[model samples]
Target: MEKKVTLPKHKFHIQAGDTVVVIGGNSKGLRGVVKEVIVEKDRARVEGVAMITKHMKPTASNPQGSLVKTEGSVHISNLMVIDPATGEPTRTGRKVNEKGKLQRFSKKTGNFIPDAYRKQ
Candidate 1:
């Protein structure tokens, strides 16, 4: 048998809990926090952004089927990270920060982008 090789993992531009704006699709111009990132599909689920309805079958909890509402996945390319400093959507870039570690920064304003999840 031949040896199998694995490719490098993809680095997502966005992560969980990052505030983002939907630049396209039905939720265009809407802002929400990133709930989760679906790396396999390059999609991100944003809270209060892509509202989808699902028809559920009857279960022990209920005799009749019910409709479930939840956030839907949006393509990563359609989402833009909001710059905390500028309060505007801006492209992100990775650069070495003061701690000598790679950090995401706002390309438009040259400011370090703080990790929204680290504070808490």
Candidate 2:
């Protein structure tokens, strides 16, 4: 019988829809919302960050070969949650309220980050 090995967990507490800022790499200082979280791999793809160009070969979907630019995944360690109050990058922590609803807050500003993006 083959045994299944569990993947290591990620330290990042971020989830899909959370706004984040790139802290390292060429895309440093760029801010975008989390589009996908690859928890198993400890990476997250942020919208409008770390874009890379891919040369697509001619296919039935598109007979014309072209270059397509798309977002690339970055390690979770390179991202920091955006603080709603300060509008700056900050770490996030999870807490449970009296109502028992799990909420994420900014460690820097101590502000509750809404699940949805706050209107700018």
Off by over 4 Å in 1: 1-4
Inter-residue clash pairs, candidate 1? none
Q: Which is the leading candidate under lDDT?
A: 1
lDDT of 2 by residue, 1-120 (tens): 999998666546777888888889999999999999997788999999999999999999899989999999999889888887888888788888656887788888777777764452
Model 1 TM-score relative to the real fold:
0.90
Predicted structure with the largest TM-score when compared to the true one: 1
lDDT for 55 in candidate 2 is 100
Worst 10 residues of 1 by lDDT: 111-120
Instruction: Give the Cα RMSD of candidate 1.
Output: 1.7
Alpha-carbon shift of residue 85 in model 1 (angstroms): 1.4
Q: Mark the regions of model 2 whose C-alpha exceeds 4 Å error after superposition.
A: 1-11, 117-120
